[model samples]
Target: METSVLLIEPDPTAAQEITEILQEGGFLPVTRQSFEAVHDSVTDEMPPKAILIGTDNVKESVLSFISELKADPSTQWIPLFILSRTNEDSFRIDCFNAGADEFFLKPIHPKELLARLRGWVNRIGNFEESAFRDPLTKAYNRRYFDLHILLELQKAQKNDYPISVAFIDADKFKSINDNYGHHVGDLVLQGLSKILREKTRTSDLVARYGGEEFVILFPKASGDQAANRIQTILEYVRENPVAEYEGQLRHITFSCGVAEWKPGLSVTEWVKLADDGVYEAKGQGRNRVILSNLQTSEHDHLEEKKKVLIVAGKGMSKSIVCEIDSLAYEIQEWQQGIEEVPPEICIYVIPPTKGFDAGEYEQFRMKHLPKECKTLLLTENHKALDSFQIMATGIDGYLRGPYLPGDIELGLRRLTNLN
Candidate 1:
């Protein structure tokens, strides 16, 4: 694609010279003689890749134009250059502070100007490519998805256009790793990702949302449309298995959660609802699509009410505390050096003392205890047990060392009755 430049200079002679220089140097320069004209041109015409403002005699107006462009999010990312005849240090600082991407002097050499403009254009192109394109699947990444989805959602909310989000995850992904090794697992993901890319619409955004999970942002799509599209992709994968790995056929399946964009909800909230639907699909079966109903009670109410407190110990007890607190509970960490216990569910890390002091322990408990609170004590050495026993008057649970994810999950499940 040919690079385009917007040259904002009121001086007719300077504008003519710059336009000639840019045209000779392979840039399509669009010149504007006035500040208001430059603003109108940017809004009406196709946006240029870069903008150059002559700040020699009209520094204030040039600065104002740059500021206006920077303030508008749509034009802010375009590279901006400032040309000035003033002191290099002061002018450069002023330009940079006002968000200019580059600065040049008034007596511009054609070659140098072309080189800098080309460099800026190349750099901006590379940046945009990197920002939008996924490294693995060569599809759009989450950053692009987020930005595009936000814009689509706004249009949908304002003008009644349709938008939907689909949360996708590879089924039995861990089993893939365990069976064929990680290399083959990666190959499976890449293969599935390629198939997904081929299946999706050109206008739709398909992005990897970490690990085996992917998300698709569909503009002008209804919930039924999104579901049908996703189901077709899933069916295609099941029918055509990847057979290139070790002469073994690998059947890849996916689960999807779909949700439509609604007004008055942030993008994060909309996505979380979609994620909940994905979990529902996984719970029902491996390969299925679940559409989320905003009014449904399937969403966990406990998650809204649960609060967790995490405490750290010098030894294995820190892990133990974290594990015990993970059971069916929402938790936050207690800041170190805070004398007061902030929450009702408190997890205290018991340090091993040489001699257990019952009076001191009782005083400590009395100081930190809140009425009707559940306390979990974590200990590393058995010697700390004596102190815990002394301090165990109000304690609800005690955990020892060497905990695993399963153990923590199981313990929390039992503790919170969330089996």
Candidate 2:
């Protein structure tokens, strides 16, 4: 069980030497040619546990890249190490500020480097151990799931994708332990784990949250998509008995509550939303898949055509305008001099434009936008909105520019609660 580490180094000689050192340390080192290539590994079945940036060209752009990674929830937790040729105190401080967990000067001591990495990785969790899994079910443990959902949420936010959670609780699970004995209960849990692993996509995560409780993570999936998959699993569980208790076949059924990640929801809030659905499912008579009720109350406007007011200035891309127009929404455009907002407008698409300022935008929002209307801002990545800006301007969320139609769709979904 070797720990996998990523080395992003453009210099072949440096990369090979580092690779040798990593191999000697009993770790697996994967070398990529560029920073962009590192992101390609994010989709890998097993992403590297840590990342090492070894390069001579540690410029401002590199610092910015480090900041981006640290800003991202998913990649931020990975132990990031920067190997630099210069040992200037100011530059070293800059590296640390940009989110490098450890900074080392080049012409490195191999043993020292390996020791530091090992110590850091061990503190995070030795992937070699069963710390990440449940002993009984062999599914990921609650601790692992808790850490994983945060990363998935961050990844989903950065990539403009949806992530969903399903809280599955075994129905009448106490009865199994009470009547059939705990061994049969453990067998039933194992059977459920097997079915979950077999039924889900390899990318999806299945974890035993606790006794008779499990949670599944579905990245790039909407609530409905998660519900459909859970429904299939529910059907399978109902039709096939999990274990035999004495002479009787012990059938099992589970109720699942599914919730999709929303723009501003916290990890606890999101999980609670899904758990609420599970409660609702049990209330409605167990063994069913239920989507969270939060959407039902928040998205009441869905009963009518979603109304959108497009404020695409001259700088706004024509493609973006077309994309918004293509959505199944009642579309209205803001007239150049018009200050009055139309009634029942659910959202406002405000793209970047020259001569526009945040102060003016705030004033416009106050004067024209309805209190319930959610706003999505479009801007370049370099000028991406910060928390202060988002709060000051009263914007719900933003989409980085040079975005595709799919990106627009996802951004809209985030702001408008669209499926």
Candidate number of the best lDDT: 2
Candidate 2 residue-wise lDDT, 1-419, digit = tens: 89999898888888888899999999999888788767757435588888999756747867877766654444656789998787789888888866799998887789998999999898777553466789888889887786566556656765788899999999999998897789999999998998998999988999998889999999989999999999988888889987776677878899889998775464556788899998999999997999985654565433354667766543243334444442445666677686544634433434333433688777777777778888877664444456687787777777664443245556766766654
Worst 10 residues of 1 by lDDT: 319-328
Q: Which window of 10 residues has the lowest lDDT sum in candidate 2?
A: 347-356
The RMSD of every model to the true structure, in order and in angstroms, is 14.6, 10.0
TM-score of 2: 0.56
Superposed model 1: Cα runs more than 4 Å off: 1-49, 53-61, 71-75, 83-93, 104-110, 124-134, 139-160, 198-203, 239-243, 246-249, 296-419
Model 2, position 351, has a per-residue lDDT of 34
Estimate the lDDT of model 2. 0.75
Model 1 TM-score, all chains together: 0.55
> What is the lDDT, from 0 to 100, of the residue 93 in candidate 1?
77
Q: Which stretches of candidate 2 lie over 4 Å from their true place?
A: 1-3, 16-45, 59-73, 81-132, 239-241, 244-249, 262-273, 292-297, 300-419
